[model samples]
Target: MIDTHAHLDFSQYDTDREQVIEECRRNGVQFIINIGVDFQTSKASVDLAEKYDFIYASVGYHPHDAKAMTDSIFEEIAQLATHPKVVAIGEIGLDYYRDMSPRDIQKAAFIRQLQLAERLKKPVVLHIRQAMEPAFEILRRHPGNYGVLHAFPGNAKEAAEGVRMGYLIAFGGPITYPNSQGPQVAASLSLSKIVTETDCPYLTPQQFRGKRNRPDYVRFVIDKLTELFPRYSRDDIVRITSKNAARLFNLPVDDSPELAYMIGKSLYLNLTSRCTNNCYFCPRNSGFHVAGHNLRLNQEPQEKDILTAVERYSGYNEIVFCGIGEPTLRADLMISLAAELKSKKLPIRLNTNGQGNLIAKADLPSKMRGLIDFVSISLNAQDETTYVKICRPQFGAKVFPEILKFAKDCKEYGIVTIFSVVDVPEIDIDACKKIADKMGIPLRIREYASD
Candidate 1:
């Protein structure tokens, strides 16, 4: 996993830098982001990153060291950032713990570096302390996608603002300690809004307290994370946080086309791996990849977690109910959630099997009339026999009639209904379109994926 924030450039690593690197590699730590608190440290960080392939760096003046920042410092930082290994602009923000640098200087330096990060198109790793008000003000003033509040200690409202500004909240080793409120809150956030880091040489977990924290200790942080979020597997957290780190830092992540991707902003959910029907050409079973986004949700996330995900993405273009499982299975929850989102005027869409009515044993379209803006249903087969053969639905002969009737019902209810037929060899495309036309609804052809 990407460290995202660390202080290997500090004197703590002078004696065992090489050993640290080796241990990091052995413990499955992919990258260590060496951060700088001043010009000298920033330069040192860049030098270490240049020397070690697995090490990256961030260059900025920490609030505590803001006293040393000058106009010339910016030029030096700009020059150092040219290094490919330089990923971000901080470890920069207010730290009222010491207030070593005067408040004025700290604000000046922080704002300057914020502009620097924006100009460089790089993320900033923040070190906000008790100055949440001003720190948040500066962050909101410069809204960009590349930033994270490292070792985040803000309240839920502040965290919401950070996410709205497109920042990930990273939790470090302190999260593993018994009395650490910062990391505890961070761990409870949606997995999509969280990233894991060691913040090595500092903020060590309880077991490693007063000792130099290392990259291997990242697992301890993850342990605390699992204990807190509990919704995600340790592996899922690793993969997801690694991807988030890679995206924000512009590191090379696996760009395989097998993944599903969203163009702009949208709230996403990864519901389930299990499906009621085994459609021969459906990607739901093989692995539902959303372009570069993986939708193989390991477990059913709690409604609270789902709502958190929705809240984290409320600033998006829309919140879509396209998850690995049929959204209808969680119909009651989805409908209730849709009403909440409706209160916020958030657009909502449902990617379904077109059997919500059958599953709920009621009129779903009318039930969801004002709550859902769009309904996309899979109409993989035109007739009962083809439906049974292709979909292998649990409902057998009843599936085809139920789906067609549901699609028609959705259309009649004035909902934007889309009937989709997977492009499989055995499934007649023209027949599916004819069925859609007969129902007076729009038709779509979905790609037949392995699962």
Candidate 2:
């Protein structure tokens, strides 16, 4: 997890800063960006970043402190920004609600800092308050992934515009509170541009509401967000939001492969683990990895959850429901999900062991008329005896003939059916091709190994 906004340089953490930083590390908080509100705080943030490799710094003057901004201080900030640890030029912007600094001074500081951000090629962390209109106007004038609207107060229109200009929207601790618009706004925004932050030493989450907030508690904000956005799992949120942070802040995040990732123009779903056959060449035997993606899901994804994963990586050429397992075990889910994805013109495909007839305890092939555009069945063996010996299906000898019937019925339904084999030692590819020809459908020979 990444804390996109925090102030570890503040006095509140001075008592036990090292311990807090260590705690953040222990709690799986991989990175933290300490934000500076003025020259002194900015210097302190740089100092913290220099001390810890995982901590980055963002330097700028807050609108509340705009009264203190001057030519020399601005130049000092410009110099401080050159520090290698600095990643952005904020928490800067208008704060008319507090009126701690006059509107004109705050505007001047905000505009100057934005110009500095553009000059430095760094994203800006904005702090707009009850001044979305003016902030939007200024942002419209100076744009391009401008930065996150830190602790964004509910403004759907402004949030949409910020996303359009390639800005991210960060949700902090306030979203965890009951009866808050922050969460509603978060639900409304594109999850692609959303990130989570702690805003440490302020706006602690509901469980720790009246206390000092820490970077680690950013997980609580994420947890609340997970509750608000039920479709997204914790891992999905972490991966997607982490990607957004890395893109905007240029974070050097890890490039670990996905358990279900895009290959070419397709998105493959792999949340299912239950399968009927235990083929000798089962890919799961190889560290549960498939095409570099770890297909071992912690839990089976619900139908809606599958759609959620699709939506996260949507707009692919097609969505394929195939993994290390027999996808037909969740035949109902695949059918319903395919029906839903079809409306979006996503063209759904399902690669299975052709055991749907047995699992549903009824004829299942023709049931997939409008639900799926394509179906591929694993036909590792041509005859029942060889199939029982190699595929080792739990259904025993009868399973192979049932698979053949399933493929034939699928072809009759005009579902663009195909049969494929893994090219193991004892399998007869020619025999499988002959069966495919006789069945009036095509046969595909899948690669035996990804490497």
Local distance difference test, each candidate: 0.77, 0.83
Candidate 1's C-alpha runs over 4 A off are 259-451
Model 2 residue 194 lDDT score: 86
Per-residue CA lDDT of model 1 for 291-328, tens digit only, reads 33666665676667666665544346666786666778
Worst 10 residues of 2 by lDDT: 255-264
Model 2 TM-score relative to the real fold: 0.63
Best by lDDT: 2
Total backbone clashes of candidate 1, pairs 3 or more residues apart or in separate chains = 11
| TM-score per candidate, chains pooled | 0.62, 0.63
Clashing pairs in 2: none
* lDDT against true structure, model 2: 0.83
Cα lDDT tens digits, model 2, 1-451, are 8999999989898789899999899999988999999999999999999999999999999999999989999999999998888999999999989999999999999999999999999999989999988988888888643788899985677677777776789998888888888877887775666888999989899998899999999888878877776755666677667767876788887554343576546788775777888887786665565433557777788877676666677546778888778788877877777777778876778898998999899777777887888998988898999999988899999998899999888888878898998877778889988998998888888656421
